[model samples]
Target: MKQDTPTPLQEADDSGFAVRVTQSAKSVAAKVLPVSSGATALLFGVVMFLVTFGMVMVFAASSVDSVRSEQNILSVVFRQGLFTFFGIPLMLIAARVKEGFYRRVAVWGVLLGIALQCLVFTPLGDEYGGNRNWIRFGDFVSIQPSEFVKLALAVWIGFVLSRKGGRVREFIPAWIPVAPVAILAIGLVMLGRDFGTVVIMVALVFGAMFIAGVKIRHLLAPLIVVSVVAVPIVLSSPSRVRRIQHFFDGCTEAEYYAGCWQQLHGTWAMSGGGVLGVGLGNSRAKWNWLPEADSDYIFAIIAEELGMIGAITVLLLYAVMTYAFIRIIREAQSPFTKIVTGAVMVWIVGQAFVNIAVVLGLLPVLGVPLPLVSAGGSQTLATLLAIGVVLALARSDRQSSQDGEAPEDVRLAVRAEGRA
Candidate 1:
């Protein structure tokens, strides 16, 4: 017997009306967003805002130092501005890149990164504050290979993991390829004695693993290994030891004259601004009272110049950016794109919090620049490029949807049994 065919029309009632309204709204969304196309725009806005705000803050924070070093106040800001100019275009170009292009370069990029890191131990290496993480090309140009390596390693990990399918849950085929490479990549960074960057890289790896469906129990081994290796490195330098020992000193007047100098001053600069801030360009700490005013502790200046309100605003911008990243991760069709985008989000957002924690004295001072806000050309360029990859992923979803097809995403389905 043939069952009665269900009619498309619903009987008139409150629930039926709700269903109609929902369907109508969905149809409208399909015509407009088409799989949340707004994510790319949101990503673009947040990146632009952060970069612009960073440029302004860099000018404000560095003007004092620039004048003391060079006759012109705009000297440092101009240099940074030039880089920002270049980075913005690079970011836009990245947004136009295809996912397959990223995949093709993933392995080579990491190999190049590893080769670059080796330069830091060569004749061209430069050391500042105790970490030898930079290489110089004459007096005019310097680069931190670790920054680029961080991005490269993340991309390579994502590429490998995405190809693993259900084997990602297994110890040998999935993790052997990823874990050893990560360790080697991080091991190179460790040779520079830059533990801060290593921490961020670790978070990047962990985030990629989670997105690839690795189990929590499998992560413990790497964490334990990294911690064992990190402790000795942290103690190898007395400056790092002192920074760790007196990190919670609260910058007492006595301590301020000693190891707590930067943290103490950062605290005062932040607290002095209170709710509204001391007003932009009017910070007392910018007058050589605070070290690294424009680099690692730039957040202190943001709080001092713009106030708690301004600091919170910067955090809100980051929060919005992370939201867009989440949307891309959820919607992107390709596993490689999904993995890479998720890793980028983890690195950027996690690094931001770790940086802020240092400023607030909740954690020991580690020389980590605030993402786009800090003064470092190599760091800025590398980070902006990574963000560009995210924008590309954000667009990938819409592009796929407009084609009116579903992605096989067989890797996800193949791994479901492992997830169980």
Candidate 2:
């Protein structure tokens, strides 16, 4: 009787019908799309291109320095290559971490960063170039904890200012904690005698506060205070004072070379690069004329070897990356995402511009790197890691927006769509 109720053909047809319905439901579930495609794709492409370009330049710029020092032409290139290899994978992993997790971690993150900074005062600290900010692990490996501190402090400020739904105006409840923490962080870095990094950290804090909706008046008072104090610090040191005095001196003046040796050499390196550049790896300044050719002054080397075209190319890449990151902040589902991305963008772009301008004689030398382009292991890896976090935020924001949900509140939602 049961067998007679339905034939084999009818049963097979019923199974096919069920399969179609299930697939149709899945199709409807997956229909949502991101609000903006330009932000994600364009930014991703630009950053990826810049990283690759940086890797190429690292090989070119560091090769000579390597051969001259270690007698191995590939020594620096090999190390850079290794870091790039690790950095790429690390970036991919960071891109997958939850945005909420990044937000929550800011609390402990800042604390850890401060602790690491304190380590510099301990025996673990190593002095280099008159700055005791570096942490030496061995002959060839070490980390600059101050570099990581910049990112952690930025995130913390963003989180703090954005707390209670972006109400950063309350002086006692809000600004009190942030200002003291920031001052402490800055004071620690200044103790290392790295005014450049301290300036960068201050910039990051201000940028975060700005994005968190803090009033200009509130932020400016501290900025003015820091500047007034920094002037005396700069004046107290003979070399730093001379460097400052000579920066204002005319480029034609004799004191320019004697007093501003690094800046002058950097300018010469850039000017030597005409329309098309001397050629990759052919920098005349790398012959020890331009100091720190591979680090703070890499942009000058780039201009010297690649010309105006190459220099613009690098800047354009940065512009594209910055634009993409800004879009991410705009489309972000929450203030936290916006502030974090903004802080990072300002740090990377701001530092790059300062470094380039200094080399061009438009600004005083700040002793900062060109982000991912500069040939420092800890710096390059840390930068790539931060970029990865940005990418993660972008991806998470895209997903949340498509679902018509807040980035922090998004979760699985299921609904049945039935059709006859």
Model 1 Cα lDDT, one tens digit per residue, 1-420: 998865555444657889999999989755443123677668777878888999999999999999999979998889888889999888878877776688789899999999999999999999987789999999988999999998998789887887677777776766777887888888888888898898899999999888888877788887788788788888988888888879744557877677888988899999999999888899999999999998999999999999999999999998998898888888777777788888998898989999999999889988899998898898899999998877766566567668975433444545654676
Model 1, position 165, has a per-residue lDDT of: 75
The sequence of per-residue lDDT tens digits that candidate 2 reaches over residues 233-276 is 88877777766767787455466567667777888889999989
State which candidate has the highest TM-score.
Answer: 1
Alpha carbon lDDT at 306, candidate 2:
96
Error in Å for residue 402 of model 2? 2.4
| Candidate 2 local lDDT, residue 105 | 93
Candidate 1: misplaced stretches above 4 Å?
Answer: 1-36, 248-250, 404-420
> Could you tell me the lDDT of residue 57 within candidate 1?
95
What's the CA RMSD for each of the models? 9.4, 9.6
